[model samples]
Target: MITFEGASKHYPDGTVAVADLDLTVETGATTVFVGPSGSGKTTSLRMINRMVEPTGGTIRIDGEDIRRQDPAVLRRSIGYVIQQAGLFPHRTVLDNIATVPLLLGWRRAKARARAAELMELVGLEPAQARRYPHQLSGGQQQRVGVARALAADPPILLMDEPFSAVDPVVRTTLQDELLRLQQELHKTIVFVTHDIDEAVRLGDRIAVFRPGGVLAQYAAPERLLAEPADAFVESFIGYDRGVRRLSFFPARDLSPHEDTVFDDQTRAEDARDIAEGHGSPWVLVVSAERIPLGWVGTDQLSRVPAGVPLGDLDLAPYGHTFNIGTDSLRAALDAAVLSPAGRAVGVDEDGRVVGVVSQDDLGTAIWSVTE
Candidate 1:
């Protein structure tokens, strides 16, 4: 556990980064520091590892004053991941992950073996182990950085906007991966981010800071959302706090529209049963494997020439699919909006169609839980 007692950072240039902060980062939980620019989230994070020395007060790790220890030794004991990965350009992925292990005097073979294990743990291909940092994608490089941080098996980790550099899709993937890893490893992590949504998604406890490094509120994500300490925090969390909170609720209770689904192989006469349904005139199309292809309108299906194969006709756009059991309500809503038919297709673990959820149905599901 880390404890801060009136910790403050006053730069020589008369800048105040952190101001008399007092907080405790509990063991085995993620503590996120989030705010807009000049909030000193990064400065607070660096104080833990002694990267940025505090000009006043004290910071302790596991009951020992960090200032009492050598900054170099203290940093080596803690794992840190920052934006853009900060990997050595010339080092192979394996060697980059193995750096700290080798520094601690582990045998070269053992360190490399540890590196190989972490690479797979972070979901990297073994084939990429031989590639340089430049050869990997931005997401891949971030993975390598995470592996390197975990290489020493530190109990605490510090992340400063680590996922902010990647595109939204990859950033979400990385966020999910971190949550998955935290479940298994249970590291005491300190994360920094400007995005309230990212903080709500990954943080067990969030610290909302004001512009002067003043800690405004520190609480669990749910509490922070349900009750903001002041207008500043409310403004920072955005007007969509209620909508964002839906992500915490399970989507399992949602009842999908099973009858609206029609196999692409269904004959025009067989599809006549769907035309009388009160829902949208469009129906989902699926392959023989049960994978979603797109959408098809009942009017078009009704006009199909008798004896013509349904598979030979064109299909409208289907947008995207979200797993019923795994995805959040936000994802369901997103899928519904993207779909040309104003519905979302629910898929199984193997990507086969399970059913569909309409926009109205999804909104009702969200209201049921939120209300």
Candidate 2:
């Protein structure tokens, strides 16, 4: 949807921020621009909506040269969100969110209704509309800003470190929310961030820029992690990107043992034998209908009657678990982190016991990526 051809920018001070950049962001794709300070990532993004005019070359939006488009009309058609939310302090949240649509000549009632719908879309309450920016938390303010950008229902959005000012937990929430919104809306988006992890997590394709705005690599997260362009890009993505990539892979890869699931009716002694046979202390408990129940250790069965209910004993934690049949490596890693014990359990979609994936399985996945 967006293409940059021989784009370059130079400051009045003669510092080259970007040079001869040529790139394409697939329509409706979340293309992230990432780099350190002074890399020109920010400047390149600004040129998209003409916030920063390019010194040379043409930028095209769906094949029409953006330079020829009227700045006011072009901007109104392209949504923009920036760091710290950039919300006006005196404005009510609803008014702030309705800013873009109102500017586009939408009726007052129509704009407000649109704003309310967008607020709900971003997971905010309609009651918060009356609150001023000062009254809302920083995260809430960011949501308001997002709602405002989306207020006009523009075909494109340019977000510059939009989630950076908030706390990490809130930032993650916003990232996940953006992913969900993108999946539904599919707006052509250009996102800028300094954090590599954030770029990888959110970007459909990442453009890594070096000093002077050099484009190092533009590729999918897996491709970049599996094969970085050079030392600079490799260092930027971090040495552990391969393992970090696991978050995208489903946790179902890890499988738990098939026949050892405990349920409400199964005798405790039998469960113990199953666990003991594996040389493990516990077995995953499930319903007779194959839903997850919890877990029980073999040691606990010695204290109970032959038919002692699986639910009756002091239940162990549910095994570090995920659905099996997806990717064992992902499940194994989650299990390792969640496990107080050594192994991770796997359950099927129906919640029935499936198999187990161990740390060794995790090792193989990580090694394979690097190798």
TM-scores of the candidates are: 0.83, 0.87
Cα-lDDT of candidate 1: 0.90
lDDT (10s digit) by residue, model 1, range 1-371: 99999999988898889999999999999999999999999999999998898999999999989889988788888999989999998889999999999989999999999999999999999999999998989999999999999999999999999999999999999999999999999999999999999999899999999998899999999889888999999999999897777777766678887676777777754565564465467778788898888887778877878755556778887888888889888778888889988898998879999988988899889878777
lDDT of 2 by residue, 1-371 (tens): 89999999988999999998999999989999999988999999999999999999999999999988899999999999999999999899999999988888989999999888998999998889999999999999999988899988899999999998999999999999999999999999999999999998899999999998899999998788878999999999998876776766665443345655667777889888877887777676767777666666677787788877787776667655666666435555777668655556666666566765556666765675446
Our tally of clashes for model 2 stands at 11
Alpha-carbon runs more than 4 Å astray in model 2: 264-282, 285-319, 325-328, 348-353, 361-371
Q: List the residue pairs that clash in candidate 1.
A: none
lDDT of each candidate versus the true structure: 0.90, 0.84
Clashes of 1: 0
